[model samples]
Target: MAFSPASYSQNQPVLDALSRCIAACEMCADACLHEDHVKMMVPCIRLDRDCADICRLTAAFIARGSDHAKHVLRECIEICQKCADECGQHQHDHCQQCAAACRACVEACQQYAG
Candidate 1:
């Protein structure tokens, strides 16, 4: 299914954070793939992808005001934190940016995760 951020007008902060996190995750993954030691970055790449997917789902569910949005948010925050931690271990610019974005996303998702 196709998802559109334009449809989500409320919770602007959360929406924006989620969007940023997705972009960061994608960029981090691509950067990881291009690294000389790609094998060593497998975990970071996996976490980035997982965090991005959960963030996207959380935004969609929240936009729709789904009853399960909180559940998704809970998972999203956890993955965001994990992704940030993983990315923080790397010294690449993409990893650093992704970590920062994921941290911001974690804060944004906290309110709704309750």
Candidate 2:
């Protein structure tokens, strides 16, 4: 699909960041499921799923040059921040990785939002 030069250039970093965040959330969710206290991890798993879905949707919106993408991206930033805060409470490596990803996404999204 052809993208307008302005939209394509503006959204490149947002798309890249969103992709990384999605991958991180998916991986973290899988890891959380594998934890010994899988039942106790229900909330984290849910948030991870939510964050991943938003990131994916945000990327799609930006790619399609949707006018409402900035609004969606703002919401995505909020969700990523919440997910990161939640994931940071864990001691597992997966959660740590997820926290980092969330933080990175937050910064990227903030840049786009500004």
Q: How well does each candidate superpose onto the true structure, as a TM-score?
A: 0.90, 0.92
lDDT minimum window of 10 residues, candidate 1: 1-10
Judge candidate 2 against the unseen true structure and give its global Cα lDDT, from 0 to 1: 0.88
lDDT of each: 0.89, 0.88
Error of 1 at 86 (Å): 0.3
Best by TM-score: 2
Q: What is the C-alpha lDDT profile of model 1 across 13-89, one tens digit per residue?
A: 79899999999999999999999999999999999999999999988887877778777888999999999999999
Write the residue-wise lDDT of candidate 2 on 1-114 in tens digits.
234767677778878888888998999999998899999888889989999999999888778867787888889999999999989999999888898898899999899777
Q: Tell me the number of clashing residue pairs for each predicted model.
A: 0, 0
